[model samples]
Target: MNLKLEPGTLDDAAHLAELRALAMRPSLERVGRFDAERARQRLLQNFTAEYTRLIKQDGLLAGFLVLRPQDKDLLLDHFYLHPDFQQRGLGSATMELVLAEADTLGKIIHVGALRDSDANRFYLRHGFVLREVAEFDNYYLRYPQHVPLRGV
Candidate 1:
């Protein structure tokens, strides 16, 4: 299995959108899909570059990650893995890549875990601490504790 993160192109928009929709629905039952749609759009609009990645095992996008930088924080804007990709370590592997990039830039990584998700647990296992829990969701940070060291 190999994972890669690279700039996403216009051609990836549709697949990326579909991935977001599939990954978000379980959490966005009552919410509209447009939320993720708008966020993705805004991301492309503001940044001259968009970082999109895929976790591939035998040439399929098993999982995906996206990020946008702000101030000193590399906000993990999006993450998704097809159900088949879940629990196979691909998500975790993809995240290690994301965190490593943030570390090289000396940025603290901040991610808002979905309001109710196993994502919180996953983040915790990965050396993140719960900074705050909101009615809407929870925030997590991984720094000094497990901040990415330079990667290969």
Candidate 2:
């Protein structure tokens, strides 16, 4: 797919926030929690340009992701794709890259998806195991495995 990543900057915050809101609308609406302003504010609240990258396909913005390093594991935060780009293997490709990086560091990756979101199945299919279920989200942890997991 010729996927590429560009380092994100604080200047991109507003744009990223817009993208996040658009990408998350369906899931949030499905869970009866869709709030336009809140969605943008939430991304701005935790946006760390240093830990984020803009995904590009053929030199166009496809989506974005944040991989924050923590004391015990990497956090897979803010992975959102444009509606036009979903269900085309880009998300899986991005995860494979992130997982490979985590494997090299021998660290687990933690992620939380909106409750009842399609992301739940996506994470599970990528080897993430459920760790917790909060009122608004479902937390998952993917351990670094030297050997490939079947069906992962």
Candidate 3:
């Protein structure tokens, strides 16, 4: 699959919000938090076109990613792949790019996955260490892999 991340825009918010709701439905329902309106509203409230990216696969919208730089680390606020695109390595590919960007910036990456969701495993597999476990989410942190100096 030809996966690419394109810059997002304000106009994409509504569509992305719907996508988020759809993509997160299973996990949300499993945790008894599946309110469609709430899910969409939550994303819309903090949506930032500047930091969002539309995940497209060979010209079709497959998902979205939202990475925001924070004081000491980068926050991976949103990452969702359509059910059709899940388990096909697209998420991992997208994560590789995200991790590379974090490494280049020398910043740690922080992300939170829904409690008991498969995303927890995905993040852990990507080198994110479990940092905290909350009521409904598990937070993780992945430190950038810095290259050693040739001569010091």
Number of the top-ranking candidate, with lDDT as the measure = 3
Give the backbone clash total of model 2.
0
- Which parts of model 3 have CA positions greater than 4 angstroms off? 148-152
The segments of candidate 2 whose C-alpha lies over 4 angstroms from its true place after superposition are 147-152
Which lDDT values do the candidates have, in the order given? 0.70, 0.93, 0.94
Candidate 1 Cα outliers beyond 4 Å, as residue runs: 30-49, 144-152
| lDDT, candidate 2, 1-152, per-residue tens | 99987899999999999999999999999988999999999999988999999999888899999999888889988899999999999999988988888998899999999988999999999999999999999999999989565697
Kindly list the per-residue Cα lDDT of model 1 for residues 40-120, writing each as its tens digit. Answer: 454445433356665576777775666777676777766778777788888888777777776667777888877667788
The order of the candidates by TM-score, greatest first, is 3, 2, 1
Which pairs of residues collide in candidate 3? none
Tens-digit per-residue lDDT, 1-152, candidate 3: 79899999999999999999999999999988899999999999988999999999999999999999889889999999988889999999999999988988899999999997899999999999999999899999999998565588
TM-score of each: 0.76, 0.94, 0.95
TM-score of 1: 0.76
Highest TM-score: which candidate?
3
In terms of lDDT, the poorest run of 10 residues in model 1 is 40-49
Q: Name the lDDT of candidate 3.
A: 0.94
Error of 3 at 68 (Å): 0.4
